[model samples]
Target: MSLRANLVLATCTACVLVLGAVPGTAGVAQAHAVLPKPVAYPARGQLAHQQAMDDGACYGWARQQTGVDPSRIASAPVPVIVPGGERVVGAARGAAAGAVVGAIGGDAGDGAATGAAVGAVAGGIAHRQHRRQAAALSAQMQSSNDWALSSYWQAWTACMTGRGYSVQ
Candidate 1:
């Protein structure tokens, strides 16, 4: 496989690993944007406390009506591959291939060392590029997700408003 593709795969593998290591990462297992906090009419004091209760009620009602769980809305940050562990794998694979190719030439050991160094450098560069692309794609996805979430939030807010709670 091409170094770039390998790096990309390795990076994705690492992302999955890191995400797996995180505790409580099993909720919903899907990406979504966050809902805007509602602007309660009563800002503070006893009425405000009551408003909090109302807000909670409205949130539950909204969730029931809209099927959008606000708690699980925001998704985890996308993983970007840093140039690390992947370099070792790349170097090893390259050396093995290079050594075979070099055996046909003359000096297998020299060829293997040179190939390994080149492979490691190439892998690092590829990993960096992959990370950049992943970051860009992630940002784009987040934008789209945010838009979708806003639409859902709007529906939820409207439902709450219809139930007689001030929602913005």
Candidate 2:
């Protein structure tokens, strides 16, 4: 197939796989519904048992419109490594330094072997250190992203539910 076709197919396949893998749970189900178009919400005082009633109405409406269980929709957590450029740069720097150190130790004849061994060990250590640092940074970034996304999604979902719209 053409490159474009292959890319499209790959993307579609990935999306399908992701959707299929999502856990089936009440919160997830409620998050995936088609948000009502031109969302309408009752006037402030018109809502009785406001939160619960609104959630139920939205869930039922979404079910009727989509023929899918509202309880099965789920919100996926956003991944944290989206901004890993800096970590990549740091890894590249470490690799260059390791290579230089290796070359410096190499000498003519036996010197070359000695230098090579030293360089290999140095490079390996540098690479490991770089990876460990990057991993730690990535973890921190992921945690922050998770917190922010979770908070935003929660608010968004609550609003949609209040508007009698199923959200996922």
The TM-score leader among the candidates is 1
Kindly report which residue stretches of model 2 are placed more than 4 angstroms away from their true locations once superposed.
1-108, 165-168
lDDT (Cα atoms) of all candidates against the true structure:
0.58, 0.42
The CA lDDT at 48 in model 1 is: 58
The residue-by-residue lDDT of candidate 1 on 1-168, one tens digit each, is 446445644654464345332223322222434556666454233365666676677777777766766566564544333333445556667777777776787756655665666666665565556556656776776776676566667766775566566656
lDDT of 1: 0.58
Most accurate candidate by lDDT: 1
Model 2 scores a C-alpha lDDT of 0.42
* Local accuracy of candidate 2 as per-residue lDDT tens digits, 1-168: 345434543443353344232222101111122223233355454454665566556556655544545223234422222221222233334445544554575523233333333434444454446446656765664565444445444554565655655444
